[model samples]
Structures are given as structure tokens and as C-alpha cells.
Target: MFSTLNWFGWALLSALFAALTAIFAKLGVAQINSDLATLIRTAIVFVLLCLYVAGTRQWSNPLALSGHSWLFLGLSGLATGASWLCYFRALQLGNAAQVAPIDKFSLVLVVIFAVLFLGERPSLREWCGIALIAGGVMVLAFKEQG
Candidate 1:
């Protein structure tokens, strides 16, 4: 399903989701502890994922996955859970506006990891975009100062 779209569309959608999530989460965390808020959000996502799995009946295909695939999936899920915990904790202690920009820096880290682990070298155009992204992030991070 994901293969049809060009990678740019995927990146755009992911960025849009991240932007909106920061805004909504900030509003949500204002009235609750980050942990509780994270729990609520996770519960909702879990329900949605479960529904999707049931609807697709993919839940019955567990045997199709190789042991290595299952191990990677489990690790990826654990990492995502850990990330949500840290994100909520940060939002609880700081403004979402601030946290979001810092969190966005993960893109830079991801580029580095891609080079190291995936052996994917970015083209010049991609590097320019990354530079622009970094500049934009810096601007957001300092928005309150000016």
C-alpha cells in the first residue's frame, strides 16, 4: 500500500501528523500529567491498531513472520513505546512549542543513522532540504525569545 506513493508524499504526511500531534498533545497535557495523557493516547492508538488488525484479519498471520522479523517488530514496538513515554515526560516538564522543535531534531539523527546502518547516502538536493529543515527547526526553537 505504501509503495504506490512517492517517498515525498509519505514524508509530508508524517510531518503533518507530527506537527498536529504536538499541538494537540500540548493542549491535552496542560490538563493532565504527561504519563496519564500518554496512557490515554496509547490506549486509543492500540484500539485503532487492533481494529485495523481485526478488519484485515492480519492477526491470524503471525506464523507468516520469520523469527527475525518478529524480533525486529517487537523491538520496534518497544522503542516506540519508550519514545512516547519520554515525549510525554518532556511535555509535562516543558512547553510543547519547545519540546516539538527539539524532537524534530530526530530527523537529523535519522539521517545519520541511515548513512551508518542503511548505507543510504543522501543526494545533494536531499542534503539541502535537510539543511533547510534544520534552519526551520532553529527558528521554531527561538520563537519565544524574539
Candidate 2:
């Protein structure tokens, strides 16, 4: 099942797991500090990835990676950590439905950032979809006053 899977398949699986992460994290953080919850979640991810890499015989020397690879990956790791911390804190205080949609606002940012930093271009159609996602997130994030 995994052999023929492509990026979309992997992305779908990631989305499923991310949904579960919101539900689980909301419950897990109910009695614990959000920071500590993030720590535990990060540790689990670290261990799981380590084991998966080793089991798949994909381990490579850190020294073998290029400076560019190391720099970008390090920056990505820092951003992921910060995102997780904020996400967990938000989930702790907000409804999962609201928080998750707001968290997914990153998708809109990704498109803009990719165009600006990575020189990727999106078509008019793609921009329309991104705009819809942004609109949806805004709708989910803002509640009407009584």
C-alpha cells in the first residue's frame, strides 16, 4: 500500500494524523501545562522518526549534509517547535474546531512564502483556492457578537 503512494497520499495521511493530534492534544493538555504537553509530543515524534529512519536503513551522517541543507533544516526545526508550542497552547484554551482551522491558516502563508522566498508561482486558480482557505479560516476564527 505504501510502495505506490505519492505526495498526495502522504499529505492525506499527514492531515489525518494532524486532526488526531488536535483531538488528543486538547485532551492531554487539559490537566497538564501546554509547554510540558508539547515537550512530550515532541519527544514522541523524535523517537518515532528516529526509529523509522533506523528501521528503514535511511540513517546518514549529519556531517555529510550540505551547509544549505543543515541551515534550512535547522531553521525548519525551530519553526516547527515554535508552531507546536503555540498550537498546543491554543488548543488548550480554544475549541478544537476553531483552533485547528486557525492553525491551518499556515496553508495560506505557505503559498505566499513559497512565492516570495522560493520563487514558486501560483496560477489565478490556485490563488483563488488559497483565498477561499484564508476566508474559511477567518470565518472559523471570528465569532459574531451577540
lDDT (CA) for every model shown? 0.87, 0.96
Could you estimate the TM-score for every candidate? 0.81, 0.97
Best by lDDT: 2
Q: Roughly what TM-score does model 2 have, to 2 decimal places?
A: 0.97
Those runs of model 1 whose alpha carbons end farther than 4 Å from true positions after fitting are 1-7, 143-146
lDDT of 2 at 76: 98
Q: What TM-score would you give candidate 1 relative to the actual structure?
A: 0.81
Across 19-136, the per-residue lDDT of candidate 2 in tens digits comes to 9999999999999999999999999999999999999999999999999999999999999999999999999999999999999999999999999999999999999999999999
The best candidate in terms of TM-score: 2
For all candidates, the clash counts are: 0, 0
lDDT of 1 at 69: 96
By how many angstroms RMSD does model 1 differ from the true structure? 2.8
lDDT tens digits, residue span 1-146, model 1: 77597889898889899889888888888888888998999999999999999998768778888999999899989988898989888877887887898888888879988999999999999989888888888888776645
